[model samples]
Structure formats: C-alpha cells, structure tokens
Target: MTCFPVVCEVESVMLEMQDPKTGVKSQPQRLVITTIPHAITGEDIVAWLTNCYSIEAEEAWALGTMLVAFGYIYPLQDHKRLVIKPDASLYRFQTPYFWPAQQWPVEDTDYAIYLAKRNIRKKGTLELYEQVQYNSLHKWMNHKWDFIVMQAKEQYRAGKERKKPDRVVFDCQERAYWVVHRPPPGTVSAMDYGLERMVDPNTEELLFSCLFSLFSSLVKYSVTYNKHDPFLAPCLPSNPWVTDDVTYWLLNMANVEIPTKMRVERWTFSFGELLSDPRGRDDFRLFLKKEFSGENLAFWEACEDLKWGTAATMNDKAQQVYKTFLTRGAPRWINIDGKTMEVTVKGLKHPHRYVLDAAQTHIFMLMKKDSFGRYLKSPVFKDTQKRAILTTVENAQSKMGIIILKRRPSISPIIVRQLEQEERARMATSGPVDITQVMSKLSNKGKEVPPSKK
Candidate 1:
C-alpha cells in the first residue's frame, strides 16, 4: 500500500523547495527528478537541488539522487565495495533486468563476478542487499514504525498547542513517485497559474509533475524506500491512497514486463534515421535502395531492457518526413509525453532517460535541497519565507511592517454626506442668500422672530 504520509511528505518537500525558510526546523523533502539523456546534464536538477538544499550546486551532488546515480549504479558500487546481490527471500526484483547486481555496474560481467564472490564470502550465498545501509529487506517497515512514533509525538503536541505543522510524511512502496506542487490553501484547482494547488496525490509522477508548478508556497515530501510491512495503520476507504500508513493499499504500476511482439516491430528505430534526411528521396522504392537500409546495430544496441505498449504517430513536418524516411531505412518511432519522435531505442515509454550503457537501470534522480527546501541564491536567504523579507536588513529597501490604513477610514461618500449635514445643522441659519440658492427661508432671520414667549 502507498503510504499517504509518504506521498504527503514528497508533496510537502516539493512545496518547501519553491519557497524555503531558515533558522527553524520545518520539513525535509525527497525529490524524484527525471529527464532526457539522464547522465549527460545534471545541471537543471543540480541547480534546483543546490538552491533548495542550501548547499552549493556542486556540493548538492553529495546527496540523494545524484549520490544514488553515481555511487549505487552497478559497476561503480560493485567495484568500490564488495557486496552481495539482494536475494529472493526478503524483497526481490520482479525481472532479471532490475536485479541489483545486473544493473549496477559499468562493466557487467566483472561486477557480477565480484557480487558472487562477496555473497559467498559473507553467508555462503551471493545476496547483496543484506549488508547495505538500506538492504532489500523490510527496513522500511521498521522505519515506518519509527516515523509513526515521531509523527504521533508531533500530532499530540499539535493538538495540544493548536500548532500548524510545517511538515508532512509519506513512503513510496510502489516504484513510481510523485511531484505534487500544492497550491496555496483553498486553491483546489489550477487557476491564475497558482502553483500551490492540491493535486490528486495519486497520479504517476509524470502526470503529477506536469500539472504541478516548478515553484510554489506549500511543502511536499516523499520517503523513497523499498519495504512493505503489515504493521502500517489502517488506510481509510475514502482515500485508499493512505492519509496514514497503508500496507494493503495496492497500486498496479511499472510492472516491468517485456515488450509485446507488435510493439517490438512498430515502435523501434535504428541509427540510420539519425544519420539520414528525407527530402532528397523522390520515390519510396528508391528511398529503400539508397543506403544500408537494414537494421542499424549502433542504435538498436542502445535499447536493452525497455518495453512499451504501442507506437505513436508523427505530426511535425520534420518529424513526419524523418518518420517516413527512417521507416524505409529500418528505423521506427515512439511516443513520449504525447510527442512522437524518432528514437534510437524502440518500444519504451521514456527512452530519453535511458543511457547507452545498459547497466544503469535507475532513471529517476532529483536535485537536493535544505531543511526548508528553498532553492535560493544565497544560503542566508533560506531563513525567510518571502523574498521581500531580505529587505529588512540594514540598507535594505524593505519596510518591516505592512502599512494598512486603519481598518475602514472615514472617507466614503455616505459618511461625507452625513458630516456635511451635521455641519450645516450646527451652523444654524445663513446670514445671506447667494444667487445659486435665491432666497432661503432660514437665511432671512431679520424679518422672522415671531418668537417663543417663555
């Protein structure tokens, strides 16, 4: 079951990242970042993490996503440290492609040998996850219990003091994580481009991240650990996603099955497409004959374990022409996020995240951020919620207090009319009449005074 606390935590972390605060304990967030050409550019993700994590963008690489990507991948992790592969007893990979030992290294065969040796040395077996900080076992269950204790303390204190919590919690037992950018309070929908809208919190990370803003006010957080336990709190039926802990909350996603026969034939592409152009071809038959119009090994070799459902159509002029030209030349096309583009790898939903190196299987990596999760320029700015707060310092243009006119001032037309009537009554009678008023009965005081004899 997907933990609501975990989902909320991930969402909160996302919120904290947009506007970070310092000097106080707020919340910690785990970001799940994904992109094309995964290893080539960590700039966008790194810059983001450094901003929120309050570390130098360069230093941000020391933690979380980047850490996992660089240190935990097969060959590097395998070579640097002797470790056993996670076994079948506790938590197991559904497919051979996902096995820890198989996908972790740059050099596959050597790493596998190393893993085997380590496992045999440790327990007369080749299991790796048993010796790590977070093994392939039910570590998250214990972690979940610990979280409940902490949350219970916080929840009880919150109830007593009527305190608004600055943090939330959650766990992602399922593989997919979310980027929930909650809008400011009461904003349940996307309007005025507000970033803090509350999302379904139950969507694929792709769907969630697309809808949520890259900037926002609220905090979203996630706990990404691989463990499921029976001790979790009973999840409410109305929200099967787990506002609390839910071990039974089941979600079927990322099943990791191989590609179907039709998908294999239709959705794949070859390197020939990347090397060719379509405009010169006069005839379809001629187009097939011109080049080495066979399956290109360079491109096909890049796609190792990816599998997808179906093929998508090409739309743009360049894409359409390239699509036809490449298809004739032994290439195929695939759709990603609704855009059909030619790919070197065929039959996958997101091939951009896959590198040519077959050993690096984990694609999602997020930037790092600070306790409050702001991605500000200076680490000092992490202390404040709003940017204008920085102005309160010496030589700063910011005014500390918001100048509000005392509630409702006496400046309304209705109030002005009342004051004018009161003034006229106090003045009593007018001494003379002007041309505008002609002759006023109250003004002719000299002729009046029939008097009251008391």
Candidate 2:
C-alpha cells in the first residue's frame, strides 16, 4: 500500500494561575495547532473536522473561500514511488539482456552470483526467484506494454517468420510498454484488438496487489535475527486508505488514452511506418490538422528525415528544421517544452544526427498522448478500417464463391447405395489380378518350357 502525508489541526484550552487566586476566576487560553484543508474560504481544516466529528459549525472564513473549497475532493496518489528507476550501480541484477535491458555492463553468470549474494544478505535466503520475476515484469511493464500488438493479416506474409521477436520496448514518449512476438501460425478466425482506451485504475491497484503478494512471499523466506525472532510476517494492506493519492493522480494522468499492449506475440510497429505510409501519415496529419496541432507531427517527421538523411542533407536542412520547429518566433513552431526547445536550439549551430533527439522525442510523445488516441478513433481511421474489412470480406467471398463445394453430404446418415454398389463393381473389374494367380501362371509356363532347356 502507498503512503501519503496528511495534515490536521488540533486545539487546546489552558487554565491560568489567575483562576487559582480568585478560587473561581477562570482564564481561558486558546491554543491553536497549525494545519490545513480545503472547504469554503477560511473554513480551514479545523472547521471541517469539527463539523464532521462533533456539531454544527458556524462559518468563520469569507464566503468566497468557502465556495472555492466546496466539493473539491482531494486526489488519490495510489502509485507513489512505485516506478523504481534504479541507478546503474544497483542494476547489478538486471544488466545482462540487451533485448529488454538495453544496457549491459557484466556477464550473465557473474550477475547471477552478485544477485545471489545480494539476496542472501537482504532476504536471509538464496531465493532470488521473486527478485528476477519482478525485475523482468517491471521491465516488461515499464518498457514493452505499448508497442506490441498482433495483426491477423501478418500471419500469411511469406518470409515473415511464424516466430515472434523476443523483445520488449518501453517508448518513453508514448508512455507505454509493449512485448512483441509473432502471432500463432494459423488462419485467425476472428480478431479483437483490445487496445487500452482509457486509464486503468485497476492496473495501479493490481500493481500494489502484486507488490504485497511478493512481499508476503519474501517474508516467508526470511530468517531470525539476534535478540528477536526476525519481525512479524509482513501482511497485505487491509484498508483502502493505505494507498497514496498522489500516485493514483499521476497514473491517471499517465494512463489516459496516452496511446497505450503486449503478449501473445506482439507486433512492433515503427514511427517510420506512420511517417512513410501515404494513407496513414495523411490521415494522422489530417487529424492533427483538425486539432490545430498538425505542425507537431510535421516537425517531428522533418526531424526524423533530417536525422536519417545523408550528411550533406543534414548539414543543409539542419538549420532550417531547427529554426522552423525549435525557435520561438519561427513559423510552424511546435509546442515543445521550453527546455527541449532550448536544447535543440543550442545544438543547431553545428547540428548532428542526435541534436533533435530530446525535442523530437517530446513532440513524438506529445502527438502520441495528445492526438494519437483521437486519430485511432477518428472517422478517417474508422472508415478506412470499415472499408478494409468490407474489401477483405468481398475478396474472400468472391475467391471462395457463394456455394462452397464440400467433399461429403450435409446429412451424415444419408447414403447413395446404388452409387456405392457401382463403385465396387467398377473396382472389381479394373483392379489388378491377384498375386497368387500371376505366380501360378509363371510356374506353369516355366514347367512347360524349362524341361528341354535343361
């Protein structure tokens, strides 16, 4: 469960010595405890708490403040600090594979030994299974969840391996992960692309569920410590409030149609596909144009072309691309954050291929989260998909014909007895003579002619 910091106000009243001297005189000292909350202006947390717990509270704060506070619920941060981006040094357990873990600094066996020692020290046991499981799952979730998908048509593409690529990718700009693999080798009867269309609160909830599950498993393997029997076995959170609200808010922000897939042999598609395909690119551009953000994709594509072009082309167009997209006053300037724009501009004096990486990544991601979802849902894409499906159905029906010829009758019990008898008679007349008769004929001919030859 996630934790969040909370603030509350407390009040105390004190009796002074003046009351003792008078034997009846009481001096009340109001002690105020500092804290805060949302409600009608000046309503402060103190009054809300008072009203919630005790009696009808009179409003002390101004009317404007009260209006601002009314019905404004605090947000949830249920996934706080769950995104564990460890530094290079601590990546000792996961630096081996280049497919999922991009960077490598050590050999596989060496890393295994390092993990063993590390786990034994920390967990008091040599069981590193959970660690590796989480390491892989976290890598998969953070990296590959977005890019992987299986298209039904790719199964028939000749020379395309039936095997899926063993890779996972986390596109930072897209804010999604994907696991790519080949679709199962067969004609797909029907396909359902259950693409995530909205932020899944359940994912965040499930993540904590898994975390607590792993934590419980780890505790089972723990050993006793000196002067204590280790500690009580860790248990799962019992209360919903145990989770942090800030994380949930952040996750909601991240997960919302941020153009978010994986598993069962996912297909990895390239942004180049988006840029190169005439129909696709034009459709996407049109969607962005409608949104008045067409320049973002245009700028991104230009940077990509410049980055991949020849050295001479890069040198010629680098300044133009930079000025057009990165500069503040330039025409068709994109809406990248200031930092990315500044970095891109700074590097324009002597531009290289990677100069626009930061800015391009930002724009690419901006389009992905901001416009990509809408593009998928746009009438253009829907109509295109509908047309494609209709075309496929037409082609299939035309090729196969309306009346499908079957090898057998529709009724299992119905039989043509006359046809069966005629087939048997035909086979009897046309089939080869028995092997016994052929051998007897040869024997008789040999007996009749061989006596004189001897």
Candidate 3:
C-alpha cells in the first residue's frame, strides 16, 4: 500500500523543518538522565509551525501533535504519550527511513525482533505493553523464537560499539517508531483504515468480469474502425508522402465540396466523428434543419466556441450564447431538462466558459440518439453517399505517369577529365604532322603515288 496523501504532505513539512537556517533550533539538551544531541524543544516546534504556515498557536500545536502521532517527530522524555507539550520537552526529527511515508509494513516479526532486542539490553525490564506483546509473540512464534532471539543478540552486540549518546538516541528512535505503529490497546492507530481491512470473497470474480468487459469493448472498437485508421490502411489514390500525389489530401480536405466514399463512410463510425469533420457537421446540420430541430446543433456549436474561444471574449460570448439559446422565448432556444436548466441558470449568475456544458451535453445526446440515426437512414445521407467520389485504378495510373521515367546515372566529372587528358597525351607523343605532304595527299586523293613515294 502507498502512503496516504496526509502522510505525504506531512513528510514535506518535516523536510522544511529539518532545514538548518529557517527550521526549529536544536541543541544538546540534557534530559534528566541523559544528554541528547540535536534535540528540539516542543515550544520551538510549535513556533516553527506557526511561523512557517502563518497559522494560530492552537492550530500549530495541533499540527505538531499530528506530526508526532504520525512518527515524523518522536518525543524523548515522554515516549508513551505521542503529542507535543508546547514546552521544553525534548524531541528529535525521526530519520527519513522510519517516516510513515516510507510505506514500510508494520509486521509482527519485525516488532517481535525489536522487543526481543530491547529486552536483551534492559535485562528484561521492558515496558508493560512491550512485555505483553513480547510474551504473546514469543508464544505465537514458538517454532522460530530461538532464531528471533539469536538475531536480537547480534543487533544488541552491534549497538554496543557505538558511542553512548548515539546508542541512546538510536534506541529511543526505534522505541518511538514501534510505539506509534503498535499503539496501546484502545488507542486508535493512525495507519488503520477501518473496514478496508476486511476482504470480500467475491472480489476476484467481480474483478475478472470487469477486466473481461473492458477487453471486449476495446477489441470491438478496434475492429470497427480498423479500416479507417490511416496508419493501418493505405490512403486511396496514393499516400502524398510516398508518391507526391496530393489527390488523396484534396479529396479528404475538412470542408471539401464532395467527400470521398471512404470519408462519407467514416461518419457512421461514431457521433464524435460526424461533429469533428466540418463537412459531416454540415450534412448533419442540414438534416436537423429539415427536421425543425436545428437549434440543438447550433447550441452545441456555441458551447464549443465558448470552450475554445479567447478568455477576453469568454464572458461576452457566454452571455450571447445564453441569451440566444437558453433564455425563455429565445429565437434559437434548445430543449433541456428542468434540472439541467436550473444548474445552467444558477451557474450563469456568475458565468464561466463551461456554464453551458451540462445543457450542451444533454442536447448532444438528444441529437445523437434521435436526429443522428434518422439522418443516416434519410435521403440526405444516401444522396451524399451516391455522389461520393471513388478513386479508380485508371485515375491513379494517369496521375502516376509523370513519376514513371527511368533515370540513368551519369559519368563522373573526374573520369571525363582523365579521358580528355589521355587523348591530348597520345596526340603529343605522335609528334607534329608534315603540312605540305598532308596537303598533297588531300589534293591527289584518288591518284596512285605510292610507288613513286617508295
């Protein structure tokens, strides 16, 4: 189990109290028999609480006492009574490890071990309550009583090596922790949640039924909308991100003149989908107007505007909405139950953005259950469905034609430059040509001068 909210809040206060400068003053206060280091007086604790929270002395004292009862601060002198004295009674902040917010279970085994350890140190001179518990636990755990005693002996021996003051402080801290957790009989335990401790035999069956219902609902919803999910199902024509074809987006624009077959079909998924899409809302609004119940949609739209509109215009818009749709004999008045009307009117006395939320929800359900189903079966929906554009294979092929060209990789510039240099070197190595001989050969191209030349 987690710590209660009150325990968590007290832990934060305790943290602030432990601060060096602003927290309660501490010193080596000498108790009647022992000198305890860094112990705070009760007066200082109450004063600190008053100053920190700006509360009255009485309230601060109550808060301090509560902290003590919860084991955040432990009294050194009077360990039996767990309350702030508002005087010079020495108290110390309990270690964070022992704070109630740590959610440590107050188990009998642990308490038995603590009592056994205390009995060993005090030579069996345990307090009356501790002795009673010790005896009971000893008898109940008779099988493991020897092991418990052996563990207590080890802990007692380890404490002997610590300094006298440190050992005394630790023993007091441990005693205080047990006293708070296992309080005397007839005293209420702060940790107890009465009636919650009882277990119901049918709880497991109820839990399994709830889990099955939740799982079945989730599976049904996913299956119903699986084909409409953009990630799971491909967009028709093509996905713009992959093919750079924007026809899909154009066909599904929020207020498109004509919605696609798939877009029109999505309005049947849920009432929320119809309201979310501008085109779908327009179709629904038209149907409502034909039924002479358009005021419901208008009122719902006004509420949505008020919800998302700027804060500066919130009150003015709220007043306008109330006067137009909610007031007696208003032009666009919508029907709502008497209780919802009373709540809305009372809230409008000092209007906020959500003043019409109850009425809006009422009108929404009215339209969804009555008008929405009729609209789906009426001529309006069927006409739209018939006019809804379908993406054909030929249209997609035509749009994809521009993207079908095959591209060849070009030669590198560095390779081209190297080839040019090699051609120039070959021409240079062949040396210069005889211009006169080259001209004569060109002039006597068809003449046979090979024999004379040889």
Q: Report the Cα RMSD per candidate.
A: 31.0, 26.3, 24.3
- lDDT, candidate 1, 1-454, per-residue tens: 1223433554344344334342112222222231111111234334555676689744654432422221121111122221222221111112223322232223323223333333433454533332331232224333222223333344444444532221111111112011111112342221122222223345677455654643232222111111111233211121224222221122111221232221121111222221221211111113223333222222232233222212332123223323532344535421122111222223122232232222111110111112112222323322222221111122111111111222244488988999999899877565454654555544686577796999
Q: Write the per-residue lDDT of candidate 2 for residues 29-64, one digit (tens) a residue.
A: 121231211111122332433343454343322221
Among these predictions, the greatest TM-score belongs to: 3
lDDT of 2: 0.40
Error of 1 at 433 (Å): 1.9
- Ranking the candidates on lDDT from highest down gives 3, 2, 1
Q: Is candidate 2 or candidate 3 better by TM-score?
A: 3
lDDT, model 3, position 32: 71
Measured on C-alpha atoms, candidate 1 has an lDDT of 0.28
lDDT of 1 at 114: 32
What TM-score against the true fold does each predicted structure earn?
Answer: 0.16, 0.31, 0.45
RMSD in Å for model 2:
26.3
